[model samples]
Target: MTRRTVRIAMNGVTGRMGYRQHLVRSILAIREQGGLALGGGEVLWPEPVLVGRREHALREIAERHGLTEVATDLDAVLADDSIDIYFDAQVTSAREEALKKAVAAGKHIYTEKPTATDLAGALDLARLATSAGIKHGVVQDKLFLPGLLKLKRLIDGGFFGEILSVRGEFGYWVFEGDWQEAQRPSWNYRSEDGGGIVVDMFPHWEYVLHELFGRVTTVSAHVSTHVPRRWDEQGKPYDATADDSAYGIFQLDGGAVAQINSSWSVRVNRDELVEFQVDGTHGSAVAGLRNCRVQHRSATPKPVWNPDLPVTESFRDQWQQVPDNAEFDNGFKAQWELFLRHIALDEPYHWDLLAGARGVQLAELGLRSHAEGRRLDVPELSL
Candidate 1:
């Protein structure tokens, strides 16, 4: 078998999601598995060149991971002719400029979304990448999760039988820096730093709804900063200018309504930190990060509401678990493998920069819907 190496310039490895999911779980895990087999006796391997503003951090990660290449200069990294891909997991504010440079350098682009801080910027990246004829993709990792995958299976198999609505609850309490160090970066609470639950999570919701159910046609939202003041990384108090919680109602193309609540202030009571329940005429299913449970119309229980009587029905116990018929991989890794295949083998990939732009558009409209106190239509984006 012929082995082909694709050199990737990976930026923002110093951050949590970049380091943990993209670098370690996805790229490194693929390497450990002896690279990805592209049929016809060809194997595609990843060679990562770590890029960041901090030379010390880059060098530290390189050494720890037994990697050789580390560069603080992005321009120099981009100039390397051997580099096949440029991947970014940086903050929203910084992503557009970096991705633009990568496109100029003729590198295949793969990055975390919003794609940019706003819809215009996201569309610009899409246009640039499309013009450059580069194989570009966004990190829509949730689509590959075991739970969502199972849910997709159900959708494809007609288990839903005319889906009616979707209800999603996603959140967990993030520690304030004073008593305990904040679980998320301090920038997440500051609007000036491009921090907010709306911008952060609405993108995920957009793709999930568009892919699994239907394209979101309209959105109504109410956003708030439930925790106005929080301590920073240094244990200093700062006013949180961004909304920490957001309640959104999305109208899908097929007359299905999706209501999702995203919050950093709420405590988790569900089986997973995030879960979505989809109801249909025939059945209903609830899916989380790793598990999915369904209650068909035949098995669904009916209960009478009475204040005078104690509840006797075990509602949770009635749902049947979705079996994993095949081995499941880490969601991030699975998407990474598909992206790699798209780059090396010319496999069709749908989640391009345009899809990412759609996500950004949803977020922008969601925030606008909250501010204007009305539902907004989601126009189809074209580049």
Candidate 2:
């Protein structure tokens, strides 16, 4: 068996999503599993060096993770020709410049979305990577979620004949710093730090909708700041200028409409933090993070429109739960494995920097729709 090692310089890994999801769950877990199997009695081994601005944090993370290399100097790391890949899990605003440097350094690029704060920056990064002929990708992890995977299976099996609409309900209440500690970082609520629900979540929605249904051609949205002030990590109060919630209606290429609501202020009343309900001619399915419930046209129960009488039927019980027959790995890990294979073997990778640019483009257009009080068309993004 042939064992190939791919050295990766992981930057901004001290952040929450970076530390928990990418570093620990995804990368570390992959190493623990003896890297990603590349078939033909071969495997791709990932050697990641932790990099960050905080030396203490970087060294601590490396030591705790049993990693040998930790560096605060990103320029020095990038200059090392041994590093095949450069990963950025940094805050949204800081991503483009770092990615540009990585591209210039002749390293493959992968990052968490929005890729950049706006459409132009995201597209520029894509162009930069292409010009350098480096393998570049963006995180579109939602498409790999167990629930969505099950939904995709259903769609592929013709279970949902001629899909009509998709409704996504996402988000949970984030406590204000006055009474309780904020679940997310303080930067998430400040505009100067490139914070907003639309920029953060619309990217996920863009990929999910495009992959599951079709390309989103038009969008109408309303975005607003629900909570104006929150306490910071240091227990000091700060003004939150970014929008906390976004309500949007998107029209897909095939005329399917998708309505999504994302908020940090709303409390969870559904089965999960995120859920998507798809209605079609033959059946309807609702999928959460881990589970999917389906009601076929044959199995759907008829309802009466009696307002005076008390409702007796258990409407929710009519849907049948989708069985979990297959094991599902962490979505981030799944995508990471695919990206690693794409790099190691020069395999086909669909979610490149251009797709990420599309996500950023959708978010930018969504915000523009909010500001203009009109529907905006999503122009097709090409290389």
All candidates' lDDT scores?
A: 0.95, 0.93
- Candidate 2, residues 1-383: lDDT per residue as tens digits? 78889898999889999999998999999999988999999988899999999999988888898998989889999999899999999988888899999998999998999999889899889988999989988999989899999999999999989999999999999888888898999899998899999999999999999998999999999999989989999999999999999999999999899999999999989999999999999999999998999999999888979899999978888899999889999999999999998998888998999999999999999999999999999999987
Model 2 segments more than 4 A misplaced:
none
Taking all chains together, each candidate's TM-score versus the true structure is 0.99, 0.99
Off by over 4 Å in 1: none
Worst 10 residues of 1 by lDDT: 309-318
Worst 10 residues of 2 by lDDT: 310-319
Clashes of 1: 0
Candidate 1 residue 199 C-alpha distance from true site, Å: 0.7
- The collision pairs in model 2 are none
Q: Model 1: per-residue lDDT, tens digit, 1-383?
A: 89999999999999999999999999999999999999999999999999999999999999999999999899999998999999999988899999999999999999998899999999999999999999999999999999999999999999989999999999999987888889999999999988999999999999999999999999999999999999997889999999999999999998999999999999999999999999999999999999999999998877888899987767899999999988999999999999999999899999999999999999999999999999999999898
lDDT of 2 at 40: 93
Model 2 TM-score relative to the real fold: 0.99
